[model samples]
Target: MAAESGKIDPMHQFLVEPLFGQHLVVGGYDISFTNSALWMVLTLGVLWVFMLGGMKRELVPGRWQAAVESLTGFVGNMMDANIGPKGKAFTPYVFSLFMFILFANILGMLPIGVVGLHAFTVTSHLTVTGVLAVLSFSIVLIVGFAKHKLHFFSLFVPHGTPVVMIPLIFLVELLSFLVRPFSLGLRLFVAMTAGHILLKVLAGFVINGLNAGPGIAAIVSIPSFVLMIGITLLELLVCAIQAYVFALLTSLYLNDAINLH
Candidate 1:
């Protein structure tokens, strides 16, 4: 069935087809408004409004304020649970990561067709996720260095280990640290890409089945349509889960830096 419609390009949803290209004699980069940039800006806009609106603290909290408070508390509690008392200082960083991803995922799920444009899945692209992972990794490294000074290198050398095994342990530890960003970024990119592909495939099935025949087509299409709706809801939950998982892992990494545990 998938072959009948031709092989669908999973990357098509992430392609940032440039609206225009800029030329410069010395050097230049693409300046055209791409779908990725569009969705990113939209996500930022939503985040700004949600956060700002909620900060206007009132004696009786409004819906927006309550929502913001809930998010804040959620992150705060997560940090405390994961990193103990030392985790309090890391709240801002974790909160920002969570909110950015949450907003991006939710914005992508919106009915963007009303604007006469296709919805772009920014999170599905490895470049974007890799950049975010790198940013988190940098934070972990910098904070560890600043807080622990040169002793931060001890992270790669376990304590209470036999001297003979120290070299092998260090090698394993170093590789694990190096792969943090790749793992974090790939997990998110793969999940988003796979989910979007499934959604597109199911949607195609519904359309093709409807065109095949009135009776048989309708029967098959009904289940496909139902599955599509179910997947849509599941996608929403996945979006939140991915965001939370990213933030949770980030916090855990930071905890290792701060507490050395």
Candidate 2:
């Protein structure tokens, strides 16, 4: 039905268009405000609002407090389990990253279209996720070099490798280590992008079916709608899992820096 009139572009949702028809250039770089940036700020605002909910600090926790504490505690435990005693100092960073990514992801899945609003997922872009991955990798490098100096290079070598095999092992490990940021960023971006594309295509089916009238609506739209709901639920789970995976990988990377193992 939709194809009769026009084809829906699944990639349309991922386009980062400038907002308000305003463009600015700073140092030859396009610094114009974009829909992606807007959603990121909104994500932060939403996160801030939630954080404020737990500021009551009651002796007995309320719903908001429990929700906030649960998230914080989950990240705390993850850091502890992954990095041990040294991980305690890094809990704040891990918690912030986890919360930000989680909220950003969850916000993208909001049914804003019901109110004629558009939803954009920042994590769906490699640029955003790549920056995050690089940030984590940068911190690991800084900490590693600061603590161990020249010995930091040993991170590429296995503990029990024979001297002759050390060269090959080190090269392999080095390549793998270098690929971490790319892999990390690409994982989240790909997952979010693919899921959103699938959802968008299904949504097109729903709209087209409805527009085609009752017969097509019942046949095409209804099943697509039901499947969309299931996929949306799965996407929500993916949101949490992706966030956790990112934070977990960061902690494990930090573990190498702090513990040198």
Candidate 3:
């Protein structure tokens, strides 16, 4: 819906616009550098610097090295506990997943301006999250089939089902399995999008209130500003929790595929 007069358009923030003045078209398709792409690349670059720059040989680690080491150990221990000893073999992949999502989430919180607009969050897009979720599911599917061959089909069959109910049970399980990617992607997309919308609305209220007559604006702005601050802090916590949840769910799915449970 278009924004009505006198109200802020919260959804406008999610619109993807070309970074360059002129849009780039190639082979009848638009292929322009966008705010979303820019932020994604920035996040990747930050990760590269953090991880590689931390590889110093000093016995007494500096702040940067210490932070990198701590993050490495945190993800490493998460895999060890969640996926057990075999998880170490997949540590690189799982750690990359965790870091990528973590960085993307944190980067979205930045106030940096980009191409006349504020930062664009790649994870705020359903397509981006959907791709990540599908990629994780694909890894699980490939690993499961490689390890168990035709027996991987048994994943949808309950171990001790009565003969007559096998077909019904299989259908239900298969449906659940098929929806995993959608569910995983939707969870992150919805959480981030909703939080941003709520923040925008509260911010709008504060702005609108302050623009009124001085005495009235002062009175109204106080509560709105306070509420906005509370939401901002809550969002900070949500950012970390969502990233951990995505990584944790991926690991759990991997475990199910490997152990066929």
Candidate 4:
């Protein structure tokens, strides 16, 4: 019965399929190139093109050059606002992080022509997002320890509290600190997953209803198609928002590490 249903599974698109002939396992780990890896490479390629092309020096800046400058300035301002002067040192990392995420998202939204192993969203997977989150968290931890040494542990203890509540406060802060990575990763993963699922279900209704339902069903699908278009547009905005939010939070964490409360 389940096989006969032929329903569209939104999750099917998020599957990480190996791009090579077969899955390659070295030692106990699978490091084979996957659709997600392909997309990540493609994302980097897109950044390379923008960065390289934007290098033109002319009296009047071209579109690509202007775009590149604008994006750089925007992120620079965000860093300055969040992390202050020290943020300049981390601009490259933050800029690259923002661009990688933004491009990854934009690529996934593109209506590229390819089947099976194409058009995967890296951020849709918790593994990918988790890695990014951990990288950000590690940066914060390392910076905190390097700058303050044993005093870094003070971040988990509130500056001022009653003597009796100190233990409870420390426990609460420790739990909150530990959950940062999971929260960051889950935010992106869940948002991408939910938006894609809604879009897929709406599209499936339009396709399946038209092909396999009564005349009334065909009529009902018209609105579904319209809603699908609207949702696609919203998802585009969401892609940018999620990337910005991630980068913003990373900068905030850096700021906290640099000037602990």
Clashes of each: 0, 0, 0, 0
lDDT measured at residue 256 in model 2 versus the true structure, 0 to 100: 94
True lDDT of residue 261, candidate 2: 88
Q: All models: lDDT? A: 0.85, 0.93, 0.85, 0.85
TM-score of decoy 2: 0.95
Off by over 4 Å in 2: 1-4
Using lDDT as the yardstick, the better of models 1 and 2 is 2
Q: What TM-score does candidate 1 reach?
A: 0.90
Q: Which has the higher lDDT value, candidate number 2 or candidate number 4?
A: 2
Candidate 1, clashing residue pairs? none
lDDT of 4 by residue, 112-146 (tens): 52343247788888998899999999999999999
**lDDT (C-alpha) at residue 230 in model 4:** 92
Best-fitting candidate, scored by lDDT: 2
Q: Residues 161-233, candidate 1, lDDT per residue (tens digit)?
A: 8999999998999899999999999999898889888887876667767777888567887898899899999
| 135: Cα error in model 1, Å | 0.6
Question: Where in model 3 is the C-alpha error above 4 Å?
Answer: 1-6, 113-117
How well is each residue in 48-133 modelled by candidate 3, as lDDT tens digits? 98889987957999998898888788888888887788788777887888888889888887755323448667888999999999
Candidate 1 lowest-lDDT run of ten = 1-10
* Residue pairs with backbone atoms closer than 3 Å in model 3 (clashes): none
Instruction: Kindly indicate the candidate among 1 and 4 with the higher TM-score.
Output: 4
